[model samples]
Structures are given as C-alpha cells and as structure tokens.
Target: MSGCMSSSDESDVSACNHEDQGDASPMEIPADDLATSDEDEEASNPPPTKKQKTLESKKPKTPSQIKKSTVKVGGKCSSTNCSKKALQGGHCFEHGGGYKCSEEGCTKQAKVRGKCVPHSGGNRCTQPDCTKLARLKGLCIAHGGANVCSFQNCTKTVQSKGKCIDHGGGKKCSKRGCHNQVVSDKLCFEHGGGN
Candidate 1:
C-alpha cells in the first residue's frame, strides 16, 4: 500500500508540472513577441528630444507659415483701400457698418436699446435723481465728479495735487529764483529742460 501511494503522488506532481509548463509556454511566447514589436516601433519612430521640442515651440510663425486664421466671410469691406472683413451690409464697423440705432433720426450705431449711449441714456449718473451722463466716480460734474487739488479750499482740477501749478502743485524750476514750471529734469523750457 505504501508503494502504490508513492506512485500515485508522483503521477499527481508530474501532471501539475505539465500544466504549469503549458501555461508558461503560451505566456512567454506572447511576451517575447510583444517586446520585439515594441523595439521595432521605437527604432522606426524616435520621439522628439526635450531640446528639439523647446526650439520648435520658440520658433515664431511667419505670415505665410500656414493659412488665414479667420474664416472666409466670402466678401471684403466696400470701402476703398480697406481690407477688413465686411458685416451683413457689406461694410466694416469703421465705415458706418453694422446695425444702426432704431430711434428716429438717430444715425449712430446701436449698442443696446436700439439706440446709442446718449440717446438711450446709457451710463447715467449714479446719483439719485440725476439724469446726466456719468463722467467720474459714477457722478456728474456738479456732484464732485472731477478730481480736484488736495490743498485746503483749492478748487483746481489736477492729475494729482497739493495745489494747482500757479500755487506750486508741480515741481518748480531748479534755476535760482526761477518761478517757471519745470518741464523735465527740474529745468524749465528756456533753461534747457530735458527735451
């Protein structure tokens, strides 16, 4: 009985070895073929190097490097010497083209409400009950719209100021006793102010 059991166990081990060999054979054959194919592909088409890619991206595009980027609108502007694209009325925006204001006697181009800003009351003052066009700070001129001098009680309009030029707002001339305003380099126009 011991001899019979040993023979059966040997047969079982041999069967398992055969099954393993069969599975390994198929797997190994495909793996080898795939590696060879990948090597062939790499040899045929080498990828661009980092330096080559960088140089290609840095290259500037020329006028005729390709084709016109904008889609062909089939026609050009009606104005002579103008090469701009034409809108629906065969004219460009600068050439009095595009939808006009729908308001009676208003020939200006319409932005909204079928009328221009002035006629349509667009950009009105933010001040309560104020209908004037907004000039600055969402307010009209009477509502402190423009920037004024920073000096006390000074009403002069300025880019920025402690006072207006007459009251020493800007840099004065560097010449001794010169009251003229400085143009550049701390010198007045007559004193060779930096041209």
Candidate 2:
C-alpha cells in the first residue's frame, strides 16, 4: 500500500513537469542575438544612395550617365578620355562607338529607329543639305525625301485647299514632261497623288 502511494506521487510529479515544459517551448525566443530590429536595418541600409539620386532618368542609370562620365563644351568625354567629346549616351560617329549611318555623313545616334537623329523626322543632322534620316516618313528634308509640305518646295504641300499644287494650284510637275496635278506629294497618277 505504501509503495502504491509513492508510485502515484512520482507519476503526478512527472506529469506536472511535462505539462510545464510543453507550455514553454525551447525555440520561443524574442530575437535575442538580433542587436537591433527592422528600424535599425533600414536606417543603416539607406534609400536610393547619394549618387543614384542625382541622375535624371526614371530608370536608375541612363545610357548618357554610363561609365560615370560627363561631356565638355568643345566635345570630349570628360570622364577620362581627354580627347574629343563622345556622345553623352554612347559614342558618337566621330568618337567611334560602332554605329552605322542613316545616310551619307549622317552621324545621328542609331536607336531602334535606325537613324543618327532619333525622332527629328530625320532632321537630327544640323547640316544644311544633310537630310540623312527618314525618322517621320523614312526620309529626310533634302534630296526629294519627306517634303514636309508645310514649307514651299514641292507644290505637293497638302495641308489646306491651296496647300498642295496638284490638288489646288494646278502647278506643273517638277520632273521632266509629266504634267499632272502636283499636290503636296510629288507622285503621278500611279503614285500616291497624296491628295
């Protein structure tokens, strides 16, 4: 009878110890080794960084800002070359960054648009007779390229009624002996009369 009572007492003590241990888990720690919390981590990591904020583009690094460089007044890559200025985005034709011409002597930047001038209607080249790019209509101003039509070169200027020679003024075609309605665009009947 005494042995049975002692066994009951020992079992009770063992069950109580187990229940206490189950309530308090071993892994339930509150980040004891973490010297600081999230607030401190953010404070030390920083945001956009010092130099990253100065760049102008929405994207972090623009092509012009590459190689950590700047341009000079007389045309030279101010980063380290000390020679003639390369293009701000990449290398211009003269500086030799490997881009083909839109046409002859046209050193406009070559984008997917595929011209030295990007979107100037191919007028990116500032030279007087160097209308090399066809940005708007696949051609430039000179050499019978995009007629612009707002100005007065070909009677094909078709904005208003009196605008195009063919549709309005009945001007003769500038080509040899073909006298049709010379509208803002200079194509014959078979060509898109540009009416």
Clashes per candidate (backbone, < 3 Å): 0, 13
lDDT of each: 0.61, 0.45
Model 1 per-residue lDDT tens digits across residues 115-135: 666677667788899876777
Kindly state the number of residue pairs that clash in model 1. 0
For every candidate in turn, the CA RMSD to the true structure comes to 18.9, 18.5
What tens-digit string does per-residue lDDT give for candidate 2 at 8-117? 57776555655655664444544554656666888888888666753432222223334533432223333344343344433333443323435545545455444445
Per-model TM-score on C-alpha atoms: 0.26, 0.24
Predict model 1's lDDT versus the native: 0.61
